[model samples]
Target: MLNEEQAIEARATLEELHVEHRDLDLVIDHLLLSPPPDELLVRRLKKRKLLLKDRINQLESALEPDVKA
Candidate 1:
């Protein structure tokens, strides 16, 4: 469970990452459409996007209250 301040920080980070992820998607799409696309760079950007997605999910989970089983 995050305190109020921590939760606020997490939410801000999440929003930032979401914007970045969306930007990466646009870049990737443009790369795909352009002739002679650099496969290596595209792959690297995709990997980074995946990492950001994982981090976003992790933060979202942290913001949620834990349930006792």
Candidate 2:
């Protein structure tokens, strides 16, 4: 049960992460377009992107209201 301030902070963090994820997407696309892209660097970036996705999901779930059956 997060307070209003905590919820606001969490939302802000989520927005920041979303922006970073989008930025990473652009970078990955650019990397793919160029010939002889660094395989290792791309792999690392992809891994980081996945981690950000997981964190985003977590925060989203946390922000959702709990449901009771």
Best by TM-score: 2
Each candidate structure's TM-score, on Cα atoms with residue i matched to residue i, is 0.95, 0.96
With candidate 2 superimposed using the best TM-score fit, by how many Å does residue 66's alpha carbon deviate from the native? 0.0
Per-residue alpha-carbon lDDT of candidate 2 for residues 10-30, written as tens digits (9 for 90 to 100): 999999999999999999889
Which parts of model 2 have CA positions greater than 4 angstroms off?
none
- 1 in model 2: Cα distance from truth in Å? 1.6
Listed per model in order, the count of residue pairs whose N, CA or C atoms clash below 3 Å is: 0, 0
lDDT of each: 0.98, 0.93
Q: Write the per-residue lDDT of candidate 1 for residues 12-68, one digit (tens) a residue.
A: 999999999999999999999999899999999999999999999999999999989
Highest-scoring model, lDDT? 1
Report the backbone clash tally of model 2. 0
Give the clashing pairs for model 1: none
Query: Model 1 segments beyond 4 Å from truth?
Result: none
